[model samples]
Target: MDENTAFPGASDESKAEYILSNVAEVVERILTFVPTKSLLKMTCVCKLWRNCARRVLRVQQNMTWVSASGPSNCDGHALCPKLADEVENIYILPKTVLVMVDSETFNGQDCCYKQKKARKSHHGPDSIEELNGLFPKGCDIMGVATPGIVLTPTGSHSGAPKEFQEGEAGYAIMFPRMEGVDIRPFHFCKNTISEANLVEAGLVNNTDLRVVLLFGYDAFKPGAARFLNQVLEPLARSKVLIAGGHVENVFSPKRKCCDRGSYGVVGLTLSGPKIQGASVLLEQDVSSAKAAEAIIQRLKAANLPERNTLGFMFACVGRGHNYYNNQRNVEADTFRKVFPNIPLFGFFGNGEIGCDRIVKEDYNLCDMDSDGLQHGYTTVMTLVHLG
Candidate 1:
């Protein structure tokens, strides 16, 4: 058979379209085997091909993960079946799980949660067990219940990569893990490095990223500058990607009361080889529009690769649509203006740790502003370059 025997006189584009159409529709399993990059490229081949290829991607993604929000008290336990139903294959279990709940959602007992449904009662430990059931094996679980609006990822949150691009990423933490009490995350901000807590947070010399959550007040204490510097300096020297934030209203003297005591850090140290990335903590004492514009400028300057990227944005709740004249998702909107294809997820917090480093040469950009890692007004955006 000659190259295009069945469509001998067909134009090359027509032949290509025909082949893609048949593959995308008829041999759908083959489409599943296709790389996401290639599938995305196929979408641009033409409208008909685009629809066919995209349907397959959508179907596959729908089978693999779920996104839920708006009021019901859905913890990891309630999450497993929805997860099993959505995902075709299980992504790897995380080395750890980070839980963020509004102070209301977390009952005083054992971090277990009551119902988000109209009528319900449930045990916190049992809920944890149900969540652990979602994992293939026993893995460390930690959490924070905040007095401010609590934020959490709706679907899969594969742990952050450990090591990236032949080196470790940046890192930091606020409080130490609570002693003896299993599964309770720290809620303080001693951000410095002491021998005991390093073991608690699991920091090693060779790692890619670590996320630390601090109580808002501890972020303001006297030694915060020194502690955060000690925590970030070595990682910066090794050229790692670091990002963090403080729990809002959790420790403010006038803030709503929370079950956990007033100090400590909940740190998740991510160290693995499958992903590499950068962080740009953009800040300025200016209008919301101007501040977002400044972030956009710095992102452009970073010049990240335009493919296989996901963004994690930790913005101060202080600056949102209201801050942008009641416009919604302004930070997300501006970030998309820079990398429209990248999916972004994160929280609005009391304060954050931000940096701007695209490559090894950009290491100096990893440090927070002169005031230090915990600041009330900066947008910390990180680009996870999928490996």
Candidate 2:
């Protein structure tokens, strides 16, 4: 065929360019839907495909990262201005005392002298309001004190006061707007109680399960008995025995006695859309790979979005290295293997706050307290898809 006939009014180079452009466009579109792990693999296909994949991964605009800094001498007051300007709400995971002072009081210019006593309740409105007042007007706040360290943009801190030790105490804020995606809280039981038994115990109804909180201490004989009764009664009533599975026990050296049971453990179950129901993976005597596989299976079963752009992992402090055979970050690595390229941030917490399921009976109650159930010895993953 003649040159014009073969090329259709285009040179050989131009024809090749036109075909490659179309291929790149198609590849970019496909990459958007592909999991981050697979997308990374696709980068080896060609330079054009690699470039397209990188561009798509980098331009994720659904999540915003905002941060600010203050003098090292400042306490929690230093965080107020920076937080007020950027964060609408705050979740405090404090390892030490976290005091919130009014901006004017902090500046020392005007002492309105509102010496309010710091509330002793956890996750209470009075405490939340005090934290909010530290910031400018119109800023809302909520937080839970964690026994473990807090991770911020600058660096991880124990949240201890500088007077006690030399370290910067401040806040790191990440704003994940809950406009489109479904945010479901999950709790996984380490026990091997059968689903049938769980149903009989009134813990689970068909697929729905209730979150149970267990409190115990070694010093209190009756308290331990009561705790055991609380757990065993349901099983006893149903005549079900925990045949096999890991039972998680969190021990605190700081806890010497139990006036009313100093130790506590919370249980949660999956709830929400049928497809979005929580996945309760039993991790007792299971390898990290196995646990991760189970989690991936549940995610796939729930039909989670193929493109999970952002993730927040609330893992128990005892889990990461200890549970994963001394391998550091095996849990996170396992999650990355399943949902690659997603931006994940979270700290190992002594107790995690996430919902076990959606509260339908008390719709208003759910709205009022959306904070999920508190959990221990579990890793809760809150994945977000901005499709």
Candidate 3:
């Protein structure tokens, strides 16, 4: 039978249905190449398009950083509802950490009080009360620390610990619920192995230049080389500090309490060799431009896609405008020079978290390898190839 004759009696509604079915298939293919923000907007086009976009656009992982003036005045809580409106679920970094927003300085106690109030208001009554009940008396709420000089989102100051000021407060949200990607957390204890053994363990391979290291108070005090030597030893020539610092991992339920013993290094690891990392220690002589160059070289070596790649930057609060001679956003600006049009989001963390390498075995929450590490005075960058 002729093609036209086959559907000659089809009603207008039937023809429209046929056209939409074909269009839906085409849209599914197109959605694969659409960036996340664009895909979210596409959901508003129509219900059919929304369903297709939702099915096609899978966000395997999402990390968002938000900042506002002081803790009491900050709107960091708004990030939750905003993200919930877009994605199915989210996991926030348990602490509502504070960063120095402006040049004014204040005391740590005052900053802590304001931060506590911020968390109470942001997390709501029940979650905060539950967290409080977990700790014994005299311990501060979850993620609340004595305010100190920390990295700011503005990127204009060097990460210097000035007296606490009437600055901004912010926190990070990490969501790994996307499809087609496996997100897991791993932890590596300090001095657990020799340099040779770490390499043998596949934790410090030659291609593994980007690893997040979170040192406890004892470990962080020894200086940068001490911590760098633990994983980046022998291959000390490669750039690795994309995100890390002195922050402790209090959120992990595996730990009994939020104390120094719980303060080891943890990180998320990817499955392939395409990823590379570079770090700049503000305390060292390295410049932000130089650090960005190291990452550029690594990306070139990997032959990463020029587009559709995403970047997450975790910088020390001390490395902003203060470090770059009052210059504005030098750290992020330098990174953009290489991955110019890619999507990037991160915050100036008291400590930054980034992954190193993937684990081979399956794991549950209680038995997972590591959650990631926290470090101070460093910038950790993670790059993912989406195409």
TM-score of each: 0.56, 0.36, 0.49
lDDT by residue for model 3 (220-296), tens:
44443355445533323333432444431223223322233322444443333333333322333435567556654
Hey, what RMSD does candidate 3 come out at?
Answer: 10.9
The better-scoring model by TM-score among 2 and 3 is: 3
How far in Å is the alpha carbon of 273 misplaced in model 3? 3.7
Span of 10 residues, lowest total lDDT, candidate 1: 163-172
Note the Cα lDDT for every prediction shown. Answer: 0.46, 0.37, 0.40
**For model 2, what is the alpha-carbon lDDT of residue 352?**
44
Task: List residue ranges in candidate 3 displaced over 4 A.
Answer: 1-4, 16-76, 88-182, 188-243, 248-261, 277-283, 286-304, 349-387
Between which residue pairs do clashes occur in model 2? 354-372, 354-373, 355-372
Q: What is candidate 2's lDDT per residue for 1-387, written digit by digit as tens?
A: 875776787878997666556667776776777644456667887889889877766653243332333442334334445654443432221111212222211222111111123232122233233344543332222222222222223222212111101122233333222333322211112232345545554454423332222212121233533443434444222211111111112211112222222323223222222212222332335457666667645544444454433344555656666777776656555556665644444444444444322222232112112112335576655443334
Model 1, span 1-387: residue lDDT tens: 876788888998998777766654554555567644466666776776677666665544211123323233454323334433433333222334444333333332443222222112342445444444543344454444333231223332332211111111111111112221122233224433465655455443434333332333344456555665655555455455666676532211111222233333444444334345677766745446557767666766665664544566766767655456766656666666666555554556667765666543334344434345556666677775433
What order do candidates take by lDDT, descending?
1, 3, 2
Each prediction's RMSD over C-alphas, in Å, is 13.1, 16.3, 10.9
In terms of TM-score, which candidate is strongest? 1
